[model samples]
Target: MAKNKSKKKYISGSLLFLLAFCFYMVFGPGRHRHQPKRQDTEIKNNEAKSSKDNTPLRELTTFTGKVTAIKDGDTFEVLFDGQPEKVRLADIDCPEKSQAFGKNAKQYASDLCFGKEVTVISTGKRDRYKRVVGTIITADSINVNREMIKAGYAWHYKQYSKSKELSQIEDEAREAHAGLWADAHAQAPWEWRKEKRTKKQQVSNQ
Candidate 1:
């Protein structure tokens, strides 16, 4: 009877050890092998949420501001969010101050936008002068940049822009001999700048 009791006790102890091992395998550190996949899924979800939250600002393509100063025909300063920002009209180049019809272009820009609330449609770009380049829309929804080109106050600036609509308007203005186009020798602003630079170079060489 003693030997049988001892044998039974040994079998009971072995069974308990087997049960413990099985329990550990199912619910202990060994079970954590699958946890890394869950953690990875959570991390990806967080990143996706962050990206969604930032989408609006990243896709920001337009803003509204008041035109505080008309620097020239194709450049101006705007009061946006209580700060002055310089803006350059995209896709067009206006006459320089020294060129013919330059003052008229400035005046026209001022008459159209100065001190008025305007909308700027950013082309996701900037100029070499660090000016924000975009299309300026006046209070009456007139596209100031395209209007300037249509009025012959500015050139289409094909070197920088390939807008077919702007090109068509420029053609119409030229055909009608409107504004600066009325002059038989109206020169493009880029050409005028190049000529000025060449003249300066020649003088410096002398």
Candidate 2:
């Protein structure tokens, strides 16, 4: 019985060692386990948090509205919930004001939401600007974010996207070379803003 117990103990130790070895190999704790911080990574994380904070909690209501107007790729004010409220779609980013396709992005959004009563879902909070940030869906289950990308009018803002559904659609849009994908390296609206701020700071310092 003692011998049997010894064998079991040996097996358990071996298994644990094997697991530890595998983990190290996979995650690379071999020599340098530290990863340097990257500006891109930092920007992505910030955008992600902003995206999370911008998603609605649980659409408090489902209503319809004629897109009285489209503000940009991510904003629109419709006669929704019996009152006109500006909405910013959650989890997607579009071109910046000075970027190529910026106008196209806004126009595409207008085309999709301008005359429709979209079903909005909550995941986050309204901005200080009072834009209800949420996912908008058509009665036909059409995702407005995807529609923008699929239509070749936008890019999938993976930096801010947390929804698996949106990610997949965005991936498809990329694979298919739709919209902003036409540009080899289209700068995201958020990133552009960040760059602009940095440039302004540099100029001020100089």
Candidate 3:
């Protein structure tokens, strides 16, 4: 009778141990491990959102407007928010109206953007002429500044911009002898302006 009692006590203790182990596995350290993984995923998602929000272009206030005038290959007037605003295409300089291919460049710009809705991305900075210095994206998702360089209608304006993509496209255009690149001695707009200024200074001094 004592041996039977001993066996009964041993079985009861074993059953209690199994039950405690199962309870711990369901609601203890094992369950808590999954919590850290979920927290890590949340952190990563927030970080990605923060990075996207901090993008340079995203930080600039975007303006939607319609192109009312193509002043040149690299400049235009826009009807924005019911007001007319002149915009100088950033990172490019087109020929003067008197320069070779100047008319062709203006015609190309007019064809691409005149009467089309465009989005202006600016840093809220204006040029000496009070024109907004910005990048333009047409309704068809065309980048007007880059397209001008690629078509050889404008120079990359490296003195004002350090865009490698613009430089690359300009090089390709030159290699293909597209538009202004067909002329072996195409003068940059800045150089042309400087020459004109020098001539004016000389005439004034005389």
Candidate 4:
């Protein structure tokens, strides 16, 4: 009778141990499995935030208005909807006001469309200064942006423009020694701007 009692106690303990093991297999691993799904959800959320941050501010559009002011070779002001909006010429970068041929570039642009009605093929993008970025078309159907490069008053600004015609015209102008290209060692407007900024930073640091 004592031997039978001992066997029953051992069997009861083994059954309890098996039940505990089964419980751990069903519940313990299931909890860890949910952790990966939470991590995946977090990763997806971060990707969505990154995509939103890189989106453009606006869509592309066109606007027609009178050229009210010429700020420089590549920037001007247009009288649109009874208000003056600054416009930055697209696909071209002209010399700075203090750079070589800068005055010539400004004069050429002024002669082409200033005080005349023109159309702007706006990329609907605004620069850091809140200027509208676009291509300008004069009343005479001339593309002012192309003319600037063709005449060598401006660089093709390849970082922003991929127009084959503009690139080809710029090459031809360089070969012909047109406008700024007449200078053997002409500095691009972007480089000039960078140098100026560097000088300003150095001065400030000092």
Stretches of candidate 1 off by over 4 Å are 1-61
- Models ranked on lDDT: 4, 3, 1, 2
lDDT per residue (tens digit) for residues 50-89 in model 3? 9977754222347999999988888899887687888999
RMSD values, in order shown? 13.6, 21.4, 18.4, 11.6
Off by over 4 Å in 2: 1-61
> Could you give candidate 4's per-residue lDDT for residues 82-171 as a string of tens digits?
877889999999998888899999999999999999999985888898789999998899999999898889999999888898899999
TM-score (C-alpha) between model 2 and the true structure: 0.62
Q: Model 2: how far is 106 from its true place, Å? A: 1.2
Poorest 10 consecutive residues by lDDT, candidate 3: 53-62
- Point out where model 4 deviates above 4 Å: 1-60
